[model samples]
Target: MGRPRVRFTGRTEADAEAVLAAAAAHDACLSGAPADWEIPAGCAA
Candidate 1:
């Protein structure tokens, strides 16, 4: 069997962050992601 999946969509950055936080709470491994990615122009929060 394959692992179950969950998806979230948000129109704002804060909404996106909330969804990400919820997912991470359920899976500790998700909280260890790298933080070296760059945000493109006008995409900065």
Candidate 2:
């Protein structure tokens, strides 16, 4: 089985930071991460 997925969407830079930090704090790996994770981008897979 694969790791369960978590979705993250960021309209602004701060939103992105909060999502990344929350994932890290939970020791969750952010799969398919982009070079810049804190851009105005949303990630899910």
Candidate 3:
């Protein structure tokens, strides 16, 4: 299986950041991973 993908659409940068932050927090809580998540170089705007 391949990694899952999430698509966020918005008219501003804040919207995208919010989605990424939320996803990161969700992942950390569910997987017991670190909360500090960095967006990949290629994935960041």
The whole-model lDDT of each prediction reads 0.43, 0.48, 0.50
Best-matching candidate per lDDT: 3
lDDT of 3 by residue, 5-28 (tens): 445444366466566675775465
Query: What are the per-residue Cα lDDT tens digits for candidate 1 across 1-45?
Result: 433454444347756665556455435433333232322222334
Show how many residue pairs clash in every candidate, following the order shown.
0, 0, 0
Per-residue error at 18 for model 3, in Å?
Answer: 0.4
Better of 1 and 2 by lDDT: 2
lDDT of 2 by residue, 1-45 (tens): 554544654446746765676566434345434432433233332
In model 3, which runs have C-alpha deviations exceeding 4 angstroms? 1-14, 31-45
Which one is best on TM-score? 2
Q: How close is candidate 3 to the true structure, as a TM-score?
A: 0.36
Those runs of model 2 whose alpha carbons end farther than 4 Å from true positions after fitting are 26-45
Tell me how candidate 2 scores on lDDT: 0.48
Clashing pairs in 1: none
